[model samples]
Target: MLAHLRSNPSLLKLDLYCKGIQLDDSCLVTDDGGRPILRTRAGLGSGLEAILPGGLWTNVPVTEPFAQHSPYTLHRFTSGTYWIHWQGEPVTEVALSPRPAWYDATLPNGKEMTHIGTLQGTYLGIYQAKVCEYWTAKPEKTNCKFCSVGLNLGVDDADEKSVEEVMTVVRRAREESGITYVDFNTGHYDGDTYLDILEPYILRIKEELGLLVGVQTPPHRDLKRYDGLREMGVNRVSFCFEIFDPKLFREICPGKHEEYGLDYYLEAIRYCAGLASKGPRHEPWVTNGEIIAGLEPPESSIAAIDWITSVGAVPTVCVFRPLVHTDLEDWAPPKTEEMVPVFRRLYEACMERGLPIGCAPNVHVSLVMLPEECAGLSKKRYPWQRLKLEAKKRMFKYAFERRLQTLERRVA
Candidate 1:
């Protein structure tokens, strides 16, 4: 399937996510002057690099030097030229994300605004609540073994950003950097009352910035409580089901599974989707469900996908990367070959259901990655056709320019 897709030029812009990087134990490299140039790795010798459209390749370094520590890094390289080096060797041309303007500013309370949150790509991520309730459980807890949620809870005093502080950063990011998306994710909190404390912060950011915002939370006690979120001008909501398998879900996310059973999680997601579907414009609020691949069987993963789509929500698939300092650090990630099939199957299923697979805001993969397949299955024809026509126009312009340049040389 990969070979077939590679031959079809129309199927460009492929985005792949997997556990760690390398396919086997071999180091990844791109051919430069007949020499194999080593790229980044996930760990000492782990990582995978794939050739993307236009002969561009993306190398993701996934390295785990310690039992509970794994960090992923991204690098993009062309056949003959280097664009950017994230953490390795320097490149001639680099695309660096600029610090948001508000990062350096101080708030009314004399707190440095930039210390509250940081810019990721074009999105602003604020970690207002630094502690999660799940980690406080007694021995043998199920708080998603792959997460480092509690890693910085105590030491990272600077990690917690206030609502006002985040708002100041948002204004600065928007005015100086033109950022339009903001996401808020929290560590598990011990108390159920954390939501009440967090709500006002979300409301204030939305009221002040009017930017498209996404908030991640466990299923609230009352599903209707989310209506307040929508009213607060939030554009999307993501409730994470890190692993789809019921057994693994319980084992991995014990706190969440025990607190809100699988049935309740699905119910809340469906409720949110229905609410988003009824709004004035019918622009479905970005409802998202996530599945961590490799943690469960393909069938279980597929079932989760089916469940999310059935609820009129989009499933955001995350490749299980073993993070250091997590309980599952010793576990190995699924091979890329194994992951491709799951991705293709889920992509096909979402297409058949007429569900907007990539409609979830701030998500990395969307219809853009599988344009041909998505276009073939879509009810609307304009989007894909427009893209096809644009491609043709660019090709024609290049040919015409080449011919004109040849004629000019002859005249000279």
Candidate 2:
């Protein structure tokens, strides 16, 4: 297990998620140019943001209860280097994900730029609009048991953000951070207005910045809205179902189950995936069905992956993090051995279906293990599919950069 963890950075990432790292007293993350660990983005992320070996950006758990018992500890030296030691033996040297200047900047309205949006890995993540309605449901709240969205809004994110405020932050992230993608995510809103609230921001980003843009919200009752999003140049759409097991899904995500059943989420994924071929040829589009792995059995997670890929949509598997203040705070995270098969299927299934897995430019996500990043965990190699993906990745990067350059020249 030690040798496997040492050799495969991807496996190391999964283990860190399972068994979080303990910070040595010598480590000064912020002073050393590391991003401050803030609990943002639906509460699944509340840990130290650092780059592991092999250029994998991860949000390592540090503040959680389980991390206190972890064998992995992070230490920094006087020479300004950081290393992770497992059982008092050195495992790997790591770099902090740099804190951007915009993190400290404020908008003209006196709102901090970070309150509007923050970088999740290499891209900008904006949790647009107010708290999820489920948290404020009448009589009793029905928010997801594992989600901390309600707790995070006023603490780390603003309750309300104007489109202009978002644009300002987006501009700063693009110019300063060189982010090629801007992702807007929202929790469920009354009357299914999440998409209505997001369209203006999406249009502005597409028209002005020409950066890759993605939207994650509850499945809008009207599926045709996605067709309109495709027409308007939205690059990606994601639906977070949380758990794949039908009974568990109802118990875990009561709001989602009560309003739109599990079947509806699957239908939305299938519908939006079909629109991938209908959108503008120049704009790349993908549909994602997101699930948290630790909540259900690993076999259930693998089944979810197969089902997602079967419909031409990709599966986004997040390690179920028992964030502080959430209902599931005391639950244990899934073991690394249990998760290996789930993530392994994540890679092989994508390859077998010939889905476009890793063609995006400079998209290194810290929240979840991307499908293409799981290649190291699997021994089976689809050499032909791997070759095709490499070709696609190169071509896509060239075209994306060229488009950005043209946009810059036009603005100049």
Candidate 3:
């Protein structure tokens, strides 16, 4: 697939979500022997020496890796040509994201600046506050099995950054990095108290930073809280129902489903969208229904996407990649081929309905970047077929396992 994409040169934006560090590993600079000499969590060029026109490495001061905890930078290569090494296999000749100036900067507080609050490109990824009350409740506990929130928490002394600090970082990021849009996500908080804690920070960023900001939260205790969100300068809102299947929701995200219940989540999404008043500018309060592809059935997954759209929210489907040191580390990610169609179908549906893709910036490829040959009919069909089959296969396997469990219990 990488070779095919490379030969085409027209495939512009690729949403390589859930591929993990291997997707991130795309940023490493390799020696002549193909061994990585340096690894960066930022954009590709950060760790690469100034390679001459002939591709010869030179002695240069390579900036430290950009660390916003996103995989968008991997999409920007010179002229959008790069390679992705997945599970040790090289998916070569892919396009990389444009390196932002703020990829390597230091803040007023002596903190390394790499757009700590938001990332650049077609996808806008944000961590509203580094700290979550869930982590506070169990200091030893990690974030949800799918998150890397603890990566920053484990290293930094401060868990949550002040609104002043966030505003400063965002201002610097926009002025320096050319970041246009921002998405904000938080860890779980205790009760309904966290909304107040987040309001000031959200408002300051919207007013002070002045970028299109998206906020992700559980259903707000008071729907009225959304009024504050809009006044604070928020353009979109995402209430992530991570897994739409009821049983999977309980098993995978017990804390969220148990705390809020599925009906409340649906109601919140509807209410938030209504409050935001969706349209081209404020057309729909961008609502995101997050589906972890490999964990549930394809029909169920597709049904969830339909549900989100039915409620006038966009379905933001993500491949399920387990994070290291999390509860589900032993789990494996869904096949990349399997994810393509789900993405394409959901994207097409949203496009048809005029719903904006709000979860990750990359998902809304047309917003920030465009792939070269996306207009070609064949290019469009390939992703659709591949993703649909993979989604179906995984869903079947899950059902099979459940049936086997039922039989075993009867035998016992």
Candidate 4:
């Protein structure tokens, strides 16, 4: 098992999520040109971003209490090199996720570029709206127990972002970072206004930049709003129903349980998954039913993955990180052994269903292991299916890049 982990970068990433790394005295993150640790929206990632062997980008936890006891430690040498040492033995050399120049640049309105959005792996991630209504509800708050969205707003992310400001940052990310995808995430609102708040930004990104755009927000009260999103060129829609066990779901995500029941989330996922064949054929569409693994039993998480894939929607399984100051702050993260089966199912379920996993270009996520990235965890192999996916990847990349170039020339 140890040998396999050392050999496979994706497994290393999964283990790092469960057992975070400790920083050595020789380590100097930003001083050595590393990206600063900022608690962005949702606050799931608050760590140093580094690329492991085999080009796997990851956010390694350093500030959390569990990380302080980890056997893994990151070391920076006097010659300006970084290596990960496990039990005082070197495991693999790592590279810092590059700090884009625009991270230091400011907008015309004097807002910092990073305040609008930040890179998650190679793609741009913007927390599109204000704090979730659950966090701001009067008398008492009912936000997700494991989330830090309320705690992060107005700190790392700006309280509000204009569509024009977002477009400027999106253009810069594409031009400089070579990002082909942009993801916008939002929390609950009073009037199901999250979709209304996001459509303008999505339209501009599609019309002007011609990049792949995704929306991760609460399921709207009106399911038909998704049809309009598809026609508007939204390539992906993700609903984060963070726990699968019905009873636990209510306890963990009180606001979600109260506002839109778990059944509604599943229904929306099914509804949106069916929209794949109805939209513009040039635009690839995917529906993700996201869940946090550590918040529930391994069997429950696997069940969620199975149900999601059964419906032609992919499962995005996230390792529950007990971020500081959140309601679940004292909870322990799931063990890697317990999570291996969950992630293995994640890959197998998607492959068995012939879902389009890992087709996006330059989209390597740092917060969670993508389904395709979990291929290493499973012993099962699907050679024919793998071949079909490769062909699709090449075709999609070519078409998408050609569209971007044509748009750029037209604007020029």
Best by lDDT: 2
Q: Across residues 1-412, which tens digit of lDDT does each residue of candidate 4 receive? A: 5576679887899999998999999988887778888885766788889998877888988788989998899999888999998888888889999888999999998999999999998999999878999998878798999889888887788888998999999989988999999999999999999999999999989999999999999999899999999999899999999998999999999999999999999999999999999979899999999999999999999999999999999998889888999988898989999999999999999999999999998899888899988888888889999999999999999999899889989999
lDDT of each: 0.54, 0.93, 0.49, 0.91
Ranking by lDDT: 2, 4, 1, 3
lDDT of 2 by residue, 140-255 (tens): 99999999999888888998899899999999999999999999999999899999999999999988889999999999999999999999999999999988899999999999
Backbone clash tally (model 3):
22
TM-score of each: 0.68, 0.99, 0.66, 0.98
If the candidates were sorted by their TM-score against the true structure, best first, what order would they fall in?
Answer: 2, 4, 1, 3
User: What's model 4's TM-score?
Assistant: 0.98
**lDDT score at residue 279, model 3, on the 0-100 scale:** 37
| Residue clash pairs of candidate 4 | none
Tens-digit lDDT track of model 1 for 1-412: 3343334322222222332322222223322221121211111112332333433222233345431122223344443332322124331232223334465567787766544654543455555665676766777555667776566443422455666566667778767766667777665565455567667777765445545677777778777777877766566787777676778788877788778877777777888877765553422366777667778987787778788878777776655656556787777766655655556655665555555443323323211223223242233445554555456446544543454456457656
Worst 10 residues of 2 by lDDT: 1-10
Give each model's clash number: 23, 0, 22, 0
Q: Which lDDT tens digits does candidate 3 get at residues 1-412?
A: 5454334322222233333222244344341212122221111111222221212122111222211233323322444345544333544443223444554556777665443543423334545554665444443453344544545453522455667666666766556555556666666677676567667766665444445667767787788887767655566677767677888787766667657877788888777667645333321245565556667766677677777777777665544545445566566545545555555556555545545333222123311112111222133344554455456445544543454456457656
